[model samples]
Target chain A: MHEAITEEKWDIVIEPRSSLLSINWKEIWHYKDLLMLLVKRDFVAFYKQTILGPLWFFIQPLLTTAMYFLIFNKVANLTTDEVPPLLFYMAGVTCWNYFSETLTKTSDTFITNASIFGKVYFPRLVIPLSIVLSNLIRLAIQFSLFLLFWFYHLFVTGKISPHWELIWLFPFLIVLMAALGLGLGIIFSSLTTKYRDLRFLLTFGIQLLMFATPVVYPLSLASEKYKWLIAINPFTGIIETFRYIFLGKGDFNWIYLGYSCGTTVLILFAGIIIFNRVEKTFMDTV
Target chain B: MSGNAIEIRNLSKMYRLGEVGTGTLSHDLKRWWYKTRGKEDPFLKLGQENKRDTAGGDYVWALKDVSFDVKQGEVLGIIGKNGAGKSTLLKLLSRVTAPTTGTLKAKGRIASLLEVGTGFHPELTGRENIFLNGAILGMTKEEIKRKFDEIVDFAGVERYIDTPVKRYSSGMYVRLAFGVAAHLESEILIVDEVLAVGDAEFQDKCLGKMHDISSKEGRTVLFVSHNLAAIDRLCSKALLINRGKVVMENTPKKVIEEYSLTNYIPGEIIFEDNRFLKFLSLKQEGNNLKIVCDYDAPTPLEIPCLGFVISDSMGNKIFGTNPNYQPPKTPIKESAKGRLQIEILYPKLLNGRYNLSIWFGDGKVDYVVMENVLSIEIINMINYVRETYATASGPVSPIVEWKYDYKD
Candidate 1:
């Protein structure tokens, strides 16, 4: 009917698959406010009526660090490579908490948010990206708690020396952890949309995965027989590098860090592609 | 400028019926193989039209090759029976799901409110959710800030703005949610039955806002509602869909009329009495209301040359035929029981309820005359190009339209 004039430019064209790269950076940018609000909601909505409120963010890491310190260091005779037990365990628990939270929450993006997602159209990436970003607030809180313990170890006890020169590497390390968790999470979410068989497996898997990383005991305690499973794990390099820079006495290698970085980028890239493809039609399956 | 805000071409959506379990992996693999080989989808060929009553195969086309265009600033009402793909079409337009095939192109942004309070979290306060829902519906934070007061005032929930939405009454919640959606800054708005939510007063307010937005702001609107009166009043044009296909596209008045006629279920009206001769049944045949009667008359009677007249609601005879489209060659003799049938073929009597009067008459006397024997409704009968009823003399309300050429 509109054949008289030509050259129409439409803002949106919806079809089955919009190529392998179905992401629109501009659209995501426009929804940045939504991302910020959702992050705030996640941060604020959980602890509204609790007496301690956001203090639980700090309390949770403190309690886990205490439990791990007692079980692994005191009872099992595990060493922290000459670092303070409280500082080492707290640091491990803080960073590991952020990674696990991001991974688990992002892994179920399609299933948990099916109601809102089915009613409107927005860049679906805003969801997991916000989750990853919001958990950073918890990271900052728990990291400050670890920093207080770091100051006591450095000044009061003088028991451990730190690599202050490598302090600039800390932010990049957190970014690498986020990217790896997000990438793996979205891949699982996309695959599990039709068959949620993975949902039951994911919770137990994250618990076992923490042991694969060096969260409870330092990597030095791993025997030669079980080291490969711990070494190939990308979280090992992050934890070891984190220990090397802050506590000054654990395992850290450039090849290991570089390998982790490469794996993170590759998984994140693959995750984006799969997430983009699945988001278009996940409503039907979910 | 193509003067169209949206153009959908050959859009179709196929859904797998029943429980999808372990066997779906094979279907997915086969579909992928076909895609890699550059062949058409093998499953789309076997999909059945979406009909609720019929037993369908595994695949059903929720929407089948539906193509339509919406002009800029046009309010289009989509009316259809339940499970007739109305929701499917809106879901496609809203991008809630991708089509199995074909394309939908739209200029500017499209904000669809398939349901009110779509992303409204129960824990969030009203003010916070205003920004959240606004952003979810494609508004910028700055846009929401500028329109915040207007939204709150329009919803009339300013006093409860700081309270969590779960604490608010259901009416207040719907008002706030609809307020946020109505304030969305998009070029096209797609609303599906959301107006039926809230009180009657709030519904009128929402309708007024819709009218203002489409007319004053020159925004395109696609409305789907079972409220036919609302559709007729608001929409410039309407679409009637049945069984995954477009049945008609025309003005809202005509489409509504056609919708009634399309969904009408024919049944026998068995309420009549007679002196010695009585009636049997009356039902709708193809383009006619067929009347069948079994009579036991005291004496012989003439045939088809029976008197049949259909009167309008005003008690005036509208249209009828004496022979009722066909006459028998011979007269009826005295019989214990006899059969009589008449067809009111192509009775283009305008859409209204009417009563039928029947009587058996010859040249001199009348035999059996049953007055007001049946009442029936005629719908969508004015399909031709006739303009004779400009000034109807009888008691009637005629739909009117006027056009004029420009003058120097």
Candidate 2:
């Protein structure tokens, strides 16, 4: 066998299968154009043909916030601190929406993109990365709407003031939100490929997850005994951090925030490893 | 050696066939224990060939110990029957799926056009799809912009370039997809059965583009298709796969010859399983080759039983006859058998080895049995023939009838 191998132009050997994370990162980087196009496709095709078009981006968050205000603030007697109710809910909703949409879309990726993946080759990670990016555009539009509401409250009431010190932490909040959503999404996407039972469970699970986070009500409204519950949620830090910056209320617990940040990073790394492994062999199983 | 652009070595891909799911935790723990001890999987003993209706298995190798290198600027054709793992091999090379074992090293960017309208979005316009598909195939935005006009022009959908692709006819969609794929300037191009779409004119244009890509631009190409005629025309070299293994690799003529020989056989060739052979016809007329058949038996036989199988001197079946689709057929009666003769008229087959296998079978079960029955030699080297280009020799030349009228 050794002598025969020497005669061959390219030596051929069968090795034991290794994890797919061992794939060369340099190759994926070279395929970045495909990633960009997938992102562009998600952005354009999603809103292009609709009658409302890009306005749907703003309308979605605005309508969602209005519904929460009517249901949670007025009906359920949820506190919004001293900040205007509209401004308060819109800020929380925009950040929450980014994470929710990213997670929702990423979870469905294996099924939605199966036909393309089955036929051709591109970086499989490109699709999930595009989902995060496409959702960012929506977040930006909603963020602008939040800014408009903040200014209206500022001019009309002249009673509330946003904390300038908390503004320094905005970029960190974005990272925390994106990391948690993308990480959780990839994990769910990988699982759903095999046990399709998770697909139905995931839709119900995201709604439950919303109440666990401080999306509808501010984190300050929680009582002392249940404060531990808020700290345990990885999203607690992201939501609290956003409210602390915009509404100028909510305790800034650096220690819990650090804990949440650490969990987010760890989940992101683990998600990448699992996603890389699933991307290679998912075609066969899927 | 010869500036090889694509190099694949021992590229084996194993798949866990039948009910691929995450098993119970106990199974996982046992598998892990085996892996830790540096031993082969114990459950592997239970595995069976994918073709058989068998019980549970650890894994089955879809591709096993396959190795072949394709040179730069070479157009390599891969031909195989269904379940021969042709698509699996392409998917592995294109990185759509990973090989369970072995290594593949290829230089330069590789783009795969596995089907028509692969990256097209129905809501996006025809023009938008070209850019999207181009980008998916690895063309930069600027490159896509530069080639955009050529793609639209090639698809002949310029009038509806701005209209959403969903509105375009199926033919128009395929044309645009092929146009974008043809214009991709990657170092290697992998195309699989993409020529099966569009009208005849578009197919010709696609072939011309493929020829230009290989000959002029010198990109490596790997094409997989069942169309032997197209493979014979476009491919410089060929690989034949059977049952997930490479059987032969050589010039297109030689590979196709070996392939047709092994895989080609009449359904009725194997009779006595409640089958009786009834009819057979072989003839040559003009430059056109035609086949006609009439068969009947006591028991109802599956009509047009696996069509016709033609072989050569080496006992290799060169061709099989079957309708592309189930066209309307005249019904047959039990115990009724009739005679029908077929004539081949035309530009005679190029000089080569040839034979014929004709049978009327009930489904795969046969009535009339004939294996390597009829044979012919098309002699070449005629004196001062107007159409003579080379010495042509082969089995079966269809005789052509020509008539001329002159007035004095």
Candidate 3:
């Protein structure tokens, strides 16, 4: 029974039928321990020597939120759409953190992990997957901080209270942001393996993408003429939908949500296909 | 069926050997079109087989028409010279790269150690990398945990287990990597020249571990290396690859014997000194051939027989047989030494340069005429025979056969 199970698990002969685009997910599944190890390595090793250690997880989004509140709320006079500036930006920062972190690291996957991937045989997808997962730990910490701030504000105001709808959208929004970032990052990582110039473009591209998303200013504040542009931004709908349910500030346009989710799903599948293809023979080209 | 571990049929791998991106989009499209049409890749045909003899080629058939089977628990050594496609075969077997053509079916999990420390993250500690490398080698976390202590002990890096691999010396890092790799319980282990990096002691340790794993554990091992001694020591069966093909596959003894004989550089036939001799023919003599040049020869000289010797660029005498060993008793009127003709029959030297040392010498005296005359190129006489049968047949061969008739 044991032999049969082992045989059944890796029974398939992986003839080089096609490129990396055609991934054998079953093989990856067989080596899932490696994926888990990579995730653990990224999660623990990132802050191993730091004094603050895992505290930096909360510190990162907290600092970013404070900066956004100062710039977008204090200086730019951007409307928070009735939610407190702290709570307002926390929602945006929480979702945006997952996306940005996933994107930045995912795009650099090939370059950063080139040494390991070149010699070892593991699912290249495991790398991007681990990146997304490692960031998820940080997201959890940041989400806890956001909730703590929300309750503090609510407790102080007495009138402001948590809406149950927003609480439920939290996990959904996190997944959406992760899927979007991971999908795009995988695609970018695959492309950058050959054309490394994409890596340079991504640093600036991510900052520009921030403006495109309604993370700083609410989607409702955008002019109706340019609302389509905000809707076109995949993060805009997820972010707006997230804020609407959580802080009860931003408007949730189902049409935009549909578009964002559609784009996210499409990019996810496309990324998988492209990443799968690139992983197979990338050793040769990379 | 006696549990075949791996069955490879008509396996071939062709590599594009230049700068990868040199082929532009159109060129790529053209190449893709050519490949899609199932045409023989143009790149494979460009290079000569012997890479060391000539300047590097634009491309090579890293592996071509190589086919073999391994039985369960069989330790197969894949041995060859550099650029002989041993690594390519391992890479293909490990699925690091795909074969350009043909198909292979392997029965069990193949953990390929094409390199040690293959998946170790520099930023991660040795402890963390253990799990990482273990997983990359296809071991479960439970499996790694089960053998974690053994792995660390084998690597001998217990004190530095938590230290980042980047901080560790290359030896320590490879030790840790190989420790994890060798300890992992996999059905098949594919190791390529990774042992070449470790020191001799560590190499012996690794070879011992590999031997134990294959013999005791009954796991299949495909080991590729240029070290014939290690291969002979560890492997039950061996395959000798040459120019991307399996030239020989048999018991380790047979494969290594053929390899050594094929690669052996024939030693030289040297002369002690010159003497009063007219003719010395190495070809006329059977196996043993020796001659000396003498200076006190009271005779004239000749071109072909004039004391001439051969040496390498570094002045090592490769071959020079003179007729001076047995000097002529007749004293010449004029104090002139004569030349002697020497011919080597079936000079079994491999292709390389050699210098000839020449001089005139008598029974007890010698004088230099030409110290070194470099002129010799023994191209490999390797026939394209599928199998080179082993026989006690010496360098030169003579046909002899006998018919035996019994009462039956």
Candidate 4:
């Protein structure tokens, strides 16, 4: 009994720093219930006071798709690879909205939740992770709307032919976009704690980043020399590969999809490292 | 559970002195450069003590080599002046921020109540927020469900449990938030002045809950508060910290007595390093009380009035004096800076303990005031005639002239 006391076995030993790459995944797993609850908080409260409520989830992409079709397709005459204009714009809108909304909201994690972070102790990663999940729910609603239009066009017009064999790559692409957003978002959130001007830059930078992605214009329409530049964007391969699988007339394929996956892993890994360093002391700096 | 619940060794937290933007990037770059070169932090050597009002270097050590240990089930009361690093210590223990140096080893979950209602959303109803805040403080959903009714009953906001917290009055909101935190099940609890809120009755209820958490449940607790009575009543042991260091650790009564004496050291009185009066002393000789004060002044009458009050143990003013009523050669203002002192002789006072507080003013406004600067106790006293008074009848006992005439 005396030997079994295990006097030195402490459940938690906190120090000034931990290794940059070392993550306490088990500790985070312990707080999964908190993660789910926070996800509910974020997703449910987003449109709480609105008239239409969660229906706005479907309404938002519909409105954005119509607006983009008017400005980009009807006025500018940009091609959507000959897919029905509304369906084409809706797909891009749904996919891009997930990435952009998740990135923008998750990047404000530190600043927006400083009060909570300063007061209580939980897995700091829970916040950005919850944001990702909440945005995924929004994306799911918008994706169904897009899928409704796609099914209508596939059966009625019979003009668009989807590559059914490549359909397995669907959920993987959503995950890639989510990972990329979470990674970059946490990094920016960690950084903006010190340099507040990054916030102002990020608000517009995400907007400009949409044009960089092939959201409105097809990757095929990009000029020869600068096409490589657009391809450099991780989202380019993702959005293009998404269109190629469903719309069946895209220029990108599996190689670009692989490249996007690699980029997601790299950015997400770096983002976690930065976030781990920042979360401990962001309360003071913020 | 029989061993130490928490052990902190040389914990310290350093903070930058000024605003975070602009020069911070360069400092970060420089620190990164040093880290790359495998050198110690460059600015680590430059910080001074955490004296808030004083101008110091660009860095300050908020908690400097603070080390303490708590046995399982021991309730330790932390008493300190503001900015004395009590909050920093609690923050480190709660893992709110990592320390700049040193290690903290603790067993089991530790929940810290730095502020009540820490993540409570205004839009969340009282019931929803109970679940949300319970989860935030490390309670699972099932645990919150079990305690939900108890928390509501404790807060006595049962009628408005479904109402959004934004609609509750300030007192009601504080009560509800505190009720949620009080129910959190953890091995160790760190509370920081959270009982200072709510009405007095609710504060007592919170204190009672805290007492039960430590004594009845056998959990370790670290309580920080300025209320000495609460500390004395609740804590099994008390610690006094000053200037980011542990000044004393002893029984609550002795530690509190020593803490009160920090403002008035024997034979000298200095608060904030004698910012107002350079020297102050009160003494009793025979039947007279001697009050001497010295302060800095550029010219005579810059400080026109100086006085002290003698209050009973209950803080009721028994007697006081100032130079306003009488004129003296070489006025108090002219006699400041060590030239003169005031000595007053009155009829012998009753035997009782009294407190002496001093103040300096310019006849219109007080420049500085400090309480508990001196405490005087009078014992047996012989008046003009040889009559011994063992105890006090009134603040002052005076000899009265009497004749043989009886109601004539």
lDDT of 1 by residue, B100-216 (tens): 999999999999999998889889999999999999999999999999999999999988999999899999999999999999889999999997677667887898899998999
Q: Report backbone clashes per prediction.
A: 0, 31, 33, 0
Model 3 misplaced regions, further than 4 Å: A1-12, A18-26, A158-163, B20-22, B30-60, B121-126, B156-173, B264-408
DockQ scores for all predicted structures: 0.61, 0.45, 0.36, 0.64
Per-residue lDDT value at A190 in model 1: 92
Q: What docking grade does candidate 3 earn?
A: acceptable
What is candidate 3's lDDT per residue for B1-408, written digit by digit as tens?
237788888888755555656453455677678899999656556644545456676555677777888898999998776678777777778776677678788887888888888867788889888987888888888999999999999999999999889999989988999999999787889988887676656876898899999888999999986555567668999998888888998998788667655642222234445344433322112332333333334454332234555554446555554445433355323345444334444444332334455555432345445454223222233231321111112222234488888888
Question: Could you tell which candidate, 2 or 3, scores higher by TM-score?
Answer: 2
lDDT of 3 by residue, A234-284 (tens): 989898887777676677867878888899999998998887767755666
Model 4 pairs whose backbones collide = none
Worst 10 residues of 3 chain A by lDDT: A3-12
Evaluated with DockQ, which candidate comes out highest? 4
Model 3: what is its DockQ? Answer: 0.36
For model 2, the superposed segments whose C-alpha errors exceed 4 Å read A1-29, B21-29, B43-58, B264-268, B275-408
